[model samples]
Target: MNVTFRCPPELEQVLPRPVPAKVGLPDWLRRMPATAHDEVLGVELMTVKKCAPFLDAMGYGFLMPLACDLQIDKGRLSWDWDLPATPGETYSRSPVALHAAAQVRGSPFEKGAAPMLKFNAFWTIELPAGWSLLCTHPVNRTDLPFRSLTGMVDSDRYTDNFINFVAEWIDPSFSGILPRGTPVAQCIPVRRESFDYRFEVMTQDETDAFRDTRDSMDGTAGVYRRDMRVRK
Candidate 1:
């Protein structure tokens, strides 16, 4: 599916454009050992770096990056940008905005925390008809100091304005600068649909198939990767 990302001409030269998630895989993932020795098992065990499913999940979509560098001191956030405004067009000048704590009162993110932050988006996303954008935190990025709240936008229909991201400030003591182009949201296009649910017990044949698959996987690395995984 073709997706469009539009921004002001002034921002086109300054702001970081979204990137393919696979191209933005975190440094930790690349540095991790594929297999580590396990003293308890007396053998080497494959780590998440060698897990196709885990790696695929992290590389499944596009990454929305920070428009500018944001400095976070204690719990405060600030940025420095000299953006030129568009004639007769209004948009965010900063990289982030604020959401009053009262807006999330009684919610899990509240917890007496200071105001939540809304990431000021510079681009407007456009998707093909019948498809929506699922915006969530970077997959498996627990190292980040903030936790992005998940949201869904029907980009197929709503493409006029920015789809900003709201996040809870998770680490008050974290003091550092989040550089420009740091991924703030991972977006996946989803088709609009409804589905019915079913619960069932496996038939004898299904059970046998399951056993066969499990047996093939046991004590064997890359069984699923070699035989079942679909290459992209």
Candidate 2:
């Protein structure tokens, strides 16, 4: 599916372009060992680094990056952006904003939530008809200092403006620079569809099939990768 990403003329050259998530994989994933010694089993076993599904999820879709480096010192956020603003118009020129703490009340993040960080996106995304964009925290990326709240937008219909990402700050005490090009959001284009729901007990054939699959998985490594997974 073809998708278009556009930004303000002033930001076209200033901001980093969005890229596939596979290209921005965290360094830990690249450095992790494929196999590790399991103390319980007293043998070397494959780690998640060798798991196809886990890797696939990590690399799926595209990443929206931070527009500029942000300085966080003792829970205060600041930036050094000096881009020229458009004449005769008013809009946020900053790369980030904050939502009131009350907005997240009653949610798990509410208890200790600092002002929720809002990544002010400069780019506007447009997807094909019948498609929406799923914006979520970078999958399996617990290393980030914040967790992006999940949301879906009908990008196909709302392509006129930017869709900012809201996130729960993980560490108010984290004092450092969140550099430009760091992924603030992971976006996946999802085709709209309806589903019919059904629930049923396993039949004899289904039971046998399930057992066979389970036994194969228990007996060998990469059974799903070798026999079931569709190659990307």
Candidate 3:
């Protein structure tokens, strides 16, 4: 609970505060769940309880935003990554480092998948013991121009450096401003725990309890709010 974010003086001035995913929602989307379509081909998006999943995903973790403005010109795949935090600071290297898809190996991404670009990071986090940080693209944020790769860091132990965002540029023709404070990654603290691979089925008591819980939740919402979820 005592996790802390540390930044260089230059970065501290411009770094967007890490915020709950709910704050990232555009006004239109935040209202869609109540004001629009209720079902799509029998599946729901607007008002059904299932839509809560989307809301939940969009409200669960903290989003880390880009510290500066990144302007890209598709014609040459070049950029001017600039920040107001440190005026007159020279960007010797483009903040967006474009790596040819063909040059990368040892990952699930296929050859020629897309040109990969990495966002240089200026923030580092210090979490307490027995914890790790899961860094990846913001959940349900596929609308962005890039797809950031997932990474897990033992922030409690690795304190020497910052973590950057590694993403595959998804839209090749996109140009112009990727404005400052754009959420680039989501970080969630995960406690280190033991795991076993053996499988098992639910007992009769569990099956009955599951049905009871499902029926209760179906009849009324807030099952988790009322009886299950523990507040942080």
User: Could you say which candidate leads in TM-score?
Assistant: 1
Q: State in Å the error of residue 158, model 1.
A: 0.7
Q: Could you tell me every candidate's TM-score relative to the true structure?
A: 0.95, 0.95, 0.77
Error of 2 at 74 (Å): 0.7
Candidate 2: tens digits of C-alpha lDDT, residues 82-117: 897788655698899998889999888785556788
Candidate 3 residue spans exceeding 4 A from truth = 35-50, 75-94, 100-103, 106-108, 111-114, 221-226
Off by over 4 Å in 1: none
Better of 1 and 3 by lDDT: 1
- Rank ordering of all candidates by TM-score, starting from the highest: 1, 2, 3
**Stretches of candidate 2 exceeding 4 Å from the true structure:** none
The candidate 1 region of ten consecutive residues with least summed lDDT is 83-92
lDDT values of the candidates?
0.89, 0.91, 0.71
lDDT of 2 at 84: 74
Give the candidates in order of lDDT, highest first. Answer: 2, 1, 3
Compared to the true structure, candidate 1 yields what TM-score? 0.95
